[model samples]
Target: MTRIASYCIAASALFLLAPSAALAQEGEATPPPAPEGQAAAAAAPAAAPAQAAPAKAEPKEDLKDKPAPNSIYAEGLGAGLWYSINYERRVIDDLGVRVGFSYISIGATVSAGNSSSSASASLLTFPITASYLGVRSGKHALEVGGGVSVTYATAQASNSFGSSASGSGVGAYGSAMVGYRLHPVDGAGFNFRVGAMALIGPGFNVFGDDPTAFGVLPFGYISLGASF
Candidate 1:
């Protein structure tokens, strides 16, 4: 009976010690508590990512008022020291007006029945004409014009017949001309033209009689010009 009582006491002591051992193991397994501030920081939602400012668009350049397409032409011709200048203007496409001016002087000898006469003359003429542009295309054209002219002439003659004479006269003339023109593509390029002209005057000839000034006055010319 004494041995049995000692065994029961030992069993009771083991039961109390076993409970203390289990509680210590549980405490060791548990994590440490965080600070209040740290806990709040961890639980709060993350701040929204900062938005980027919109980029300012740069201002564009202002370009306006370009040049227009157009041209200016000048024409010129000459024979020896005598020369002419002409210009044409179009009031309507394919039809236009032409005007020109020239100066000339010549000396000649006339022989008739042993009477030899030395004659000299100087003349200035201005022609105003209206033209039709019959054919015009890319770089070439055909043109015709008819008009009147104004002339002023001075002449002096001395002959073996013992006669000397000097005279000055102003005359009106009827005239016609035709032309071929070449237009250049470049703004400052050379333009070319060729043409024939004839004239008739009602008064005494500026050169001589019989043949008359108009009889041998038909002439051809070549010109060079420029376009703007």
Candidate 2:
């Protein structure tokens, strides 16, 4: 009977010890699994920083693809009752080239030895011009150029005796001008120019009774024009 009691007590103690050993093993395994889950949670924040880096870099790259505004221009020429057309290309800053045409007229009255004579002339002036334009400010500008001015002129004269005289010739001209430019809308503009011009050189008479009489004359012109 004592042996049977000892056996029962020993069995109860072994069963309790076996349960404690199993619980210790379970505790150790649970700690390693918890550490792996925490490591994965920490790595999630690192992935967020990597995503944020690309977001910060994107705007700078996009701005690089954008284009800048154009500072150059092209304009056309228009003037008063005399109609003319021209083109100008902005080469650098405020410098450019100008080429165009103009129709001109002149008149004079002379008295020699008690004889009064009235004379009038008309011409078509073609100018192939090159100019240096200053920096444009507000609505004002200044320009100067030298070029060949070709003119075909016809003159008519009438004396107190009702007699008539007519002659035709060709001439050369040169000029300098100051102007105001107006910008009223996009792709369009206008200019007002006032200048002094000189016309000189000799040409043959296209229509006259005397072909052997060669003449040389020099004159000045006050000119105005507009541009677009």
Name the candidate that leads on TM-score. Answer: 1
Q: Write the per-residue lDDT of candidate 1 for residues 77-140, one digit (tens) a residue.
A: 3221145566655555556676677888999998989789899999887767676764776557
Q: Please, what is the TM-score per model?
A: 0.48, 0.42
lDDT of each: 0.66, 0.51
lDDT of 2 by residue, 162-187 (tens): 89999998766443333443321122
Tell me the spans in candidate 1 whose CA falls farther than 4 Å from its real position. 1-83, 107-119, 157-164, 184-188, 202-209, 213-218
Residue 6 CA displacement from its true place in model 2, Å? 2.5
Task: For candidate 1, give the lDDT.
Answer: 0.66
Model 2 misplacement above 4 A: 1-8, 28-43, 46-124, 151-190, 197-221, 225-228
Worst 10 residues of 2 by lDDT: 64-73
> For model 2, which pairs clash?
none
For model 2 the local lDDT of residue 103 reads: 67
Q: In candidate 1, what residue range of length 10 has the lowest lDDT sum?
A: 62-71
